[model samples]
Target: MNDISAQAATLQWNDQGLVPAIAQDWQTGEVLMLAWMNREALELTVREGRAIYWSRSRGALWRKGEESGNVQHLKELRIDCDADTVLMKVEQVGDIACHTGRRSCFYQRLENGEWQVTDPVLKDPQTLYGKS
Candidate 1:
């Protein structure tokens, strides 16, 4: 609001008022992962200088490392002109951000109707989640 229209009015958002946010390493530019965010998430990310996400499943707000301690230290945020997507540069601590024990969530590839894990897990989930 507040006449931000001049700065952001063209970005595309989904029907549910959410946008896809991609997280990347600030220095390396390697895509780390992607998450969802609403206006609240975007605001929090900018105001707090930390990664925040909208948990579709949990139906609530979630701050990175709130429970897992695998925090994402935000470095930069890039909003596409369309105002519907965001690119976050962050410093990820710990070995895993995905509950599956992988460093990133995009470790699986669907091939021939079979799910194949494509990346090696950087740490054991149990070590992070305590045998959950």
Candidate 2:
């Protein structure tokens, strides 16, 4: 834990005291999702070996899969050269990473100048989070 804190101290957090964390598939190297991590959230993620993000909307620490069961187990964590961003190589449980039930958050592509969703939802959000 101390080691993680020492490493995290080297990161260049933004004015909001958060860094952008990019989660990637450990085996395939596909990017999953982008989230924010405050100091505590980052530390907890390292300690817990799972994805823990700071929710800008709810203003709290969001434990990935707490509601949806799409938790990302941390395989490796890296800091960029500029120390402004974090990369997490994770094993995504349930094979879903997006709240929209897609495999990745970046499942949209722009074709002919029009944004289109290029991936299918592996599971329904309502099925995971319950109707509400």
Candidate 3:
């Protein structure tokens, strides 16, 4: 098998045949987002040198920044010891990773028994997605 296929074969996929993938900023080490990947997505990501995920809601392959202008260029990919999770260090283009127009999907923090939004939206979602 090819390198991509060999690497993918080592992963421990869930019952749904999906594994969790985490995207982190290549320079800052800040986690940008968490998504799922099937074998196809994982192979495509390795070959294309970009982030590709399986969107459960859409039930299809999701190319990062396909709708917006915030593509993630892969720098490095690592698998956890258990081989069930993937961590990707990438250069985030347009400084946005979240569909909400935020730099990271982890925008919420819990403090004092309440959840608060910590990151500001870099761009308006409507503007990014052309929703309005």
- Measured with C-alpha atoms, the lDDT of residue 114 in candidate 2 is 96
lDDT of 1 by residue, 1-132 (tens): 223333333558799978999988787787778899877777777777788999999989889888778888889777877667889899888766787777888888899999999999776777676664
lDDT for residue 80 in candidate 1, whole number 0-100: 77
Estimate the overall C-alpha local distance difference test score of candidate 1.
0.79
Greater-TM-score candidate between 2 and 3: 3
Alpha carbon lDDT of each predicted model: 0.79, 0.93, 0.93
Candidate 3 segments exceeding 4 Å error: none
- What digit string (tens of lDDT, one per residue) describes model 2 on residues 1-132? 425888888899999999999999999999999999999999999999999999999999999999988899999998899999999999999888999989999999999999999999888888868875
What number of backbone clashes does candidate 1 have, counting pairs of residues 3 or more apart or in separate chains? 4
Better candidate by lDDT, 1 or 2: 2
RMSD of each: 3.4, 1.2, 1.5
TM-score of each: 0.80, 0.95, 0.96
Give one digit per residue, the lDDT tens place, for model 3 in 21-126: 9999989999999999999999999889999999999999999999897999889999999999999999999888999989999999999999999999989999
- Using TM-score as the measure, the top candidate is 3
